[model samples]
Target: MTKDELKQRICESVDRRRSQIEGIGDQIMVNPELGFKEFETAKLVANTMEEFGFQTETGLARTGVKAVLKGKNPGPTVALIGELDSLGVADHPMVNPETGAAHACGHNAQIAGLMGAMMAIADTQAGEELAGNVVFLAVPAEEYVEVEFRRDLVKGGEITLLGGKCELIKQGHFDDIDVAMMIHTHSDSTMKKTGVSTSSNGFVSKLIRFVGRAAHSGGSPHLGINALNAAQIAINAMHAQRETFRDSDAIRVHPIITKGGDIVNVVPAEVTMETYVRGRTKEAILDANAKVDRALRAGAMAVGAKVEIETLPGYMPLANDATMVDMFEQNSEELFGEDELTKVGHRTGSTDMGDVSHLIPAIHPMMAGASGPGHSRDWHISDKEMGYLGPAKSLAMMAVDLLYGDAEGAKAVMENHDPLMSKEEYLAFQEGVFRTEVYDGETGTSEVES
Candidate 1:
């Protein structure tokens, strides 16, 4: 069959499984789980992939899952990825009361669309006419959260990196994959139905703690050193550095105090905080991160308290492959028209996909299917057709266009693309970013963690 004919058959197959596809998306929406611990979600994804006759692997990077569909001939390998974790949005309507995990960012749709593509590709037997393999990856922990728990896991040697994709890459899960692609749900009403940015911001995380002497709140309060006061001052200092940040760098620093005190009647002796210093480039992120560290130390110095800061490598700046972006746009236009193909130049948010983009040609685009700001309680899937079925047919068709016959499309992408870093360099840089230090306010001394 011709390439176009194969694509048409794939789309038809996706349409035939519309109910099942939508059900998968809806079912996940209610059963949301957090990153690196998505056992329930992994089970569901693995079972679905196995039923479709794909060779599946589970328990990767804690809770990641993957499956491969090989073509009649051997050539380049393409990865279709989906995040299998949710964020904490306690007030969301679909939140899990037991865990406070909610699908507020529309990750549920990513997996749903991924499954739809898998179903269509397999049902149509498109691999028979192709010259490459399709790898379906359900990765965990795209959202860099639960810092304390993840840090403990790292210290325990249960995992090395905090982000799921970073850990997967460290474990060489993507070694065989030639290219990768994933779609995120867009909540901005101003954006078109779909879009792809040329690039996006990267970030590094800081886990902070302020130590002070405790005292009875209603008694001799003068005997207490207020740790909360130090935390507040540090937040203000971080804000003060914002004006110094270059607009071209697109710097963003947002910190939240995770703990205040033990009891309302007692003066708090310890305060813990977490934040990410995000920017468009590695230099920019590091520059801003250093300034944040200085500000945290300033807080402790002023209060005569102690401060501990732990720095963790977050993600690399996303540089989407130009050729891959064009192919995705072309296939999306063919399937859903060009009206929703908005030209998104650069995004401020970050994702682990950026890490993969550094080592191979990768694309992380967006499709309009939800309303309300992402990660907010109001965020949810609004258009089932465009949200669920849109990516389904688009991904399947893109794969057909890339791997059909001699696989010229996939070949051109790899040939024209230049990776930002080798796998070894990427691993070394990420590992170097992990460190901890303590500053003693009274002694004006700092000690680095071994």
Candidate 2:
């Protein structure tokens, strides 16, 4: 069969399983679980993959599941990835009341689309006509939340990295796959039915603490040192550096104070803050991070308080593979028409997929099916056909295009691609980002190490 014929068959197959696919998506949406805690979701994916006759592996990166569908011929291995996590949007209509987990980011759609593609390809035996293997992966903790909990996990040696993909890379889960693709749901109505971005920002996570002497607020205010004041100074200093950030770098730094004080009567002894420094390139992100650190130290120095700063590795900047983008674009246009396709430029947001794109050929595109601002309580899947089936058909078609006919398409993508970093270099760089520092103003002493 020709490539188009195979794609048609796959789409027809997906259509035949429309109810099942939508059911899976709806089920996941209503039962949302937070990152690193998606046991039920992972179980669902594993069971579905097993039902479809794929070899399954579970408990990867804590809650990830992987299943492989081997082709008749030996060639490249391509992975179709779906994130298995949700955000802590307590106000969302579909949020899990107890856990405050909600599928505000539309990851449920990603899983559904992944399963839809799997059902279509397996049911039609498309692998028999292809030259490469296909892997279905449901990964965990893409949102990068619950920092304190994740840090506790690290301290206990339960995991080394906060992001799921980062941990998976450290555990060698992605080592076997040569090419990867995943579709994310977007909320922008101005965009077409489907869109592909050229690149996106990456970020480094930070946790900060300010310590000072506590005393009576009414009688002996002079005996107390205000940690909250130091935090305020630090925030102002961070704002002062905004003018120095280059527009071309697309830098973003937003910090929030998690704890301000303990009581109304006593002087606060400790204050805490969390933030991320995001930029379009590694150099830019590191430069901004240094500025932030200096500002934090300045705050401590001004108030004669001690400050401890913890830095953790976050997602890397995403650079989509040009050849993979072309194949995805073609398939998108074929399914949704050229007018319904949009080409996006650089996005300011970040994803762990960006980390994957740096080491191998990968594409992270967006499909429209939802309404309201992304990650907001109002966000939801309004168009099931476009939300669930559009990506299903697009991914299935792209799989056929890449793996069919001696795997020429996959080879071309790899040939045209040059990785930003090797696996060793990538691991070293991320590990180096893990550091902690304590600066004491009164003693004029500092402790810094990575």
Best by lDDT: 2
* Error of model 1, residue 282, in angstroms: 0.8
* Per-model C-alpha RMSD: 1.1, 0.8
TM-score of 1: 0.98
Q: For each candidate, what TM-score against the reference?
A: 0.98, 0.99
Tens-place lDDT per residue, model 2, 1-450, is 898899999999999999999999999999999999999999999999999888899999899999988888999999999999999998999989999999999899999999999999999999998998999999999998999999899989989889999999999999999999999998898899888889999999999999998989998878998899999999999999999999999999999999998997888889999999999999999999999999999899998999999999999999999999888888888888877778889999999999999999999999999999998999999999988998888888888888998999999999999999999999999999999999996786889988
lDDT of each: 0.91, 0.93
Q: Looking at model 1, which ten-residue stretch has the lowest summed lDDT? A: 335-344
Q: How much is 343 displaced in model 2, in angstroms?
A: 1.7
lDDT of model 2, residue 328:
85
lDDT assessment of candidate 2: 0.93
Candidate 2: list runs displaced more than 4 Å.
none
- Clashing residue pairs in candidate 2 are none
